[model samples]
Target: MLDYSLDISAVERDLALPDLVAEGEELDALVSAEADWTQPTPAQGWTIAHQIAHLAAADANALIAIRTPEAFDTVLKQREAAGPHSADLEADAGAAKPRSVLLEQWREGRTELAAALRDIPLDRPFPWFGSDVTATLTVALRLMETWAHGQDIYDTLGVPHPPTTRLRHVASLGVAGIPLSFYAAQLPIPTVPFRVELTGPEGQTWVWGPEDAEQQVQGPALDFCLRVTQRRPLSDTALQATGADARKWLEIARVFL
Candidate 1:
């Protein structure tokens, strides 16, 4: 098995939750201001309204999970049941209603979720995706997911996504998890040490592996995260994997099932 001991403490310490909250609010505003009611997002048949509703439902579930770890499955089921509400919200997209109402719901949901996360003790364990994870790690993953899915919504809206400095959490997590996918794909392990360098949106460089290395990958962090998450194809970016093993790892990059 690949080692899961990659140090992410620095990455976690540098995360700015306030910035994530602000960006999420900005996305909510954009969703509210959208004029097209029939436009579809990349997520199957979901519209912007459905997206917002899903985010709201997810946030609510996160709040529950943060408060009572033993209730994780029940919270997930509740969130799943809210899918019909999301559909209904999307169906009313063209209705003549005050946009502020929808925005308020989104804001409230996010605020509650943030408060729950902030109140959770970092050392506390929570059930997550069939495993027990620390409260801090769970929150970090949630933030990463929110930013990535927000990007999808932004792409559908034809708006430029602002620089995602907070996305470093996702990038680091993705990079650390790449080795597992490589092993699962039955690819040969590299004989030499290698380096991986991802340049973030705000000119921040994220480097993994070794400094003096025999193999390397260097490129944009956003693109790297997208590729590793299987949200974007490797050919869509400027990322370069120099060694055979490094290239193989990229071919099967995945963070979750």
Candidate 2:
């Protein structure tokens, strides 16, 4: 059988930037007050400021990956040497700055990164923590990070995060992240393919993998997104798993390394 696949980088990029910007804006609005910045979020020991700072740092790193691969490799090495807490240390450093400075840096960095992502050749591989990724995947990860961290900010402020179509990007990334989830947990990657069928915010169905796959997961897209991002525990979500691998996947699912 002849296999045919189409590259959807352009489409993903188009949706990604706007959705990231929108998600950023929503979180930005909640942090206008000084007290809001220091408030502890759902992520243990993370404040609203830390969430934004992490994003700012990630955007800066992404810019380096796109603009100067060699430099990004250096940055990655530095991060590795700095150890696992490097991310928290980076966020702490950024959060220590005045709110205005951190906010401006995040805003500027995300904007610059988005613009750079647009001009890059989609086929060109960009350096990342574990491996190189295409520009399209890079932008989608940005969107996913923005949305996931934005949830922390919203939880901090006790505000309801209104569901939007943009979450489809997060859900898509979550689905793609299944194997990574296993790898991160030091578990063997499953050979059997699994199907995912989610109910989108607007009640539309979003499906991935093969329809005939014996292992399957089904749930609201938001629940799956929250699960894969590790934002919500499996017990807290309404997701259903039809196979052993599927059930195990929900237990260890995570989009980040």
Candidate 3:
């Protein structure tokens, strides 16, 4: 029988905070050159500035969610009135700040968020996209966001994103996101076990799901990360799907809740 439940309980709960710090520093270096700010990224119509702005806004929100409920509610209400462009509006406003100011704010914001994530109890629920969620999921979400945006920035700059063990967080998030992915797409849940087997950058095997499951996905970890993030298309990847359900899951798999 297939166990389709998305029990993230199996995933290692560690935030891998050092990995988060390293990726943040890597992105900082990418934008250190002033000219790089205006360069357009893979996100259509979004420049590098927009990419950084989006990240900064996310970090700032993390801090708000962790430290101040009142502030978070205020911002959430504002976004509600602004409608769909709400996020875009925030990003644009963030991008308008002086480059140094924006970068410093991001640095400080993420630094604070990192600290909160480090100390917060795993079971504590914090405000997230639509509901309260645990610190574990929060960090997983942040890892994917940082890595996904970094991929766009790197590709736009004609560079490769160096895959690291940190991707374990992303890979786990991708698997855990299965239920939410279906829910957001308004599709019926496929009660089929799906396995993911990937070779990490160092040739280590990283896997998810039951080995006995009939459906499986196999490939490099980087490819899995890119596909789930939607930064790169499946056609561009080397991943092989061995079952119909796995194929369909790949088509709509997304990290955001």
Candidate 4:
């Protein structure tokens, strides 16, 4: 799935770019197959069109953020001034467009964003919604969003989304997002560290944190990814937690900001 060795200890653009392309291409195929874009997805209030629109808009925003930090700040200001539901508004606006037009925009934006990420310097931080991040985290976020949103489309279409090693990126991001998940849910971050051991698609083991940590999470990699992305309910996954903090983290896990 990756050109070099898969070292998700830090997700560089090389690893994320191909995975991003794979995820986008998969969703693109599903949406392109349907003549009707008005079909509703599992995401409440979001249609199939809404899903693609959101990805397109997000990719466009990421492109600007990577290429020109100053320009991205203006975009951020506009989103802020638009208020809390601004993201929904952006999706709504794009969803209003013709399906063919929206598809073209999505493809173009994705291509451009991937290209920009390939050359971006990893040292500089750029403005995101309320924070700044470098290209490394930026590309990983793009991949995670693409895969997570693609899941909604897949479910709506009754198509199976086979797990791939590309998910290593999403899994890593999900694990790293433990703190953010707690913060988002208004829960205090746990002081104790967690050991996460997931069985990958090919039956390989992917582990994070101290192996001897008392609080632990063990499960299939796909299940962990689905849980953290909130695509699948915790009750439905094969994941197991050994302590209070580990269990609570699964309840509110989220990979996106």
Candidate 5:
């Protein structure tokens, strides 16, 4: 059986604000330097500018959820309602603003988000979805979202994002959520015992499940992370999944709601 109670502290420890800031800055630079007539990104007809705007909006929402306590639901609803308008604005030829302005807004949103996260007590309980969650989990969720969405921007620009230890946060969370994905994929629950060996950022390996398991999956941590997050196609990765069920599970990996 998959363990839902896997340790998440590793995810917390991997949340390096400096790394995130640097990645965000690189993405901003990429967006700003791109030519106006560049091909549309995989996100429909949206251009690079729209992607940065969406990231800014997402970061802003995360900050509100972390800091306001009582207003998260309302704030999220407002953001959802504004999504269509944002898309419509991007579709209009004259509606898209300068990349510089979008970059500034993105930086501002990230700044607010970082400050909010820094201020929250790690042990404090916060509202997430319909349930209370720890501040650390909230941070992990934000990191996951940022990294995952950042992949879209990076892929659209054909840029390589060097793997960081922070990615392990998403990987750990992603792996833990695998059983959920299995169920969603309408696959049979594996009855055999297995092990997952995930290498951490610093060449440290995190072993889960029994030591003498009948099956195992192992590979470079970054590829596994990318696969689980669905940021990269599973066929494009080097992760090796032994045993029938474990391989099938990796093929349908997903993390978001």
Candidate 6:
């Protein structure tokens, strides 16, 4: 009956900073010349521009959710009125803008997000995907989102996935989502817990789950992120899972809200 939510303990002051920098600069570089905005990305039916626009949309939304709840409510209402494909509508609208304009929007949005995150109190609850969570937690969640979407953009263009210490943030989110993942899959929550040991990019080992549990997953931190986000097939990675519960979690792992 214990809550398995991962304790960040230390919120990387400006958790989204590095990933934001990397993502923006990389995308900037990708379009340095007369680039192809229409190039397809890993996200189904979305082009590279759509991918970045979605991130921009998310960044702006995060800012609203963190600093202006009323504005966030308006957004939720607009999306509700627009119906199920509202997300697509938003992204497409963003993507439809001139490439230069769209890029500026993403850049400016992230810049403001950085400032908003700096002053946001940790204890203040904000409406996230389905429930209210603290601003500190939302930072890590945003970092994970930025990183995961970066994957789709890179994989779409055959670029190598960016490796960074920031991944510990995402790996933590993934490990924390095991219960929710099970709940969404309509599967029984595992009565027996498991352990997760990921060797991060900086050679730091990240540990999660219950230490004494019989089930365990261990491998490179990047692979852990890939699996949790379903950005890549497990068969393509080197993560090793021991015990039925651990293996099943890997087969159906997902952490996004």
Best by lDDT: 4
Residues 1-257 of candidate 5 have per-residue lDDT tens digits of: 23333457544423555555666676666666776624566666666666666677667666767778788988646546767464445334222666666667778888777777677877676665535666566556667767766677778878887777777667767767766677778876666766888777679886767877767888778888788777778889888887877788788887654
**Whole-model Cα lDDT of every candidate shown, in order:** 0.68, 0.83, 0.80, 0.85, 0.68, 0.78
Q: Which regions of candidate 2 deviate over 4 angstroms?
A: 1-11, 33-35
With a 3 Å backbone cut-off (N, CA, C), the pairs that clash in candidate 3 are none
Candidate 2 per-residue lDDT over residues 1-257, each given as its tens digit = 00011223334676677777787777777676545488888988888889999999999999988888889978978898999899889999998999899999998998898789888986787788877777777777888898899888877778898888888888877777777888888999899888999999999998888999999999999999988988899999999999999999999998878
Per-prediction TM-score:
0.78, 0.93, 0.92, 0.94, 0.78, 0.89
The top-ranked prediction according to TM-score is 4
Better of 2 and 3 by TM-score: 2
| Lowest lDDT 10-residue stretch of candidate 4 | 1-10
- The TM-score of candidate 2 is 0.93
lDDT of 3 by residue, 139-235 (tens): 6677779989988888888876789988888888777777667776888987888788999999999888899888899999989889888887889
Can you rank all candidates by TM-score, best first?
4, 2, 3, 6, 5, 1
Q: Each candidate's root-mean-square deviation in Å?
A: 4.8, 3.5, 3.0, 3.7, 4.2, 2.7
CA shift at 257, candidate 2, in angstroms?
1.5
Writing each residue's lDDT as its tens digit, candidate 1 over 61-107 gives: 66666777678887556536766464354335522234455557768
Show pairs that collide, candidate 1: none
In candidate 2, the residue pairs with backbone N, CA or C atoms under 3 Å apart (3 or more residues apart, or in different chains) clash, namely none
Cα lDDT for residue 142, model 6?
67
Q: For each predicted model, how many residue pairs clash, with residues at least 3 apart or on different chains?
A: 0, 0, 0, 0, 0, 0
Cα displacement (angstroms), candidate 6, residue 201, comes to 2.0
Ten-residue region with minimum lDDT total, candidate 3? 1-10
lDDT of 4 by residue, 1-257 (tens): 11111234356577677888888888888889999889898888889899999999999998888787789878978988999888889989999999999999999999998888887776777777767776777777788888888999889888899999888888888888887888888888888888999999999999888988988999999999999999999999999999999999999998765
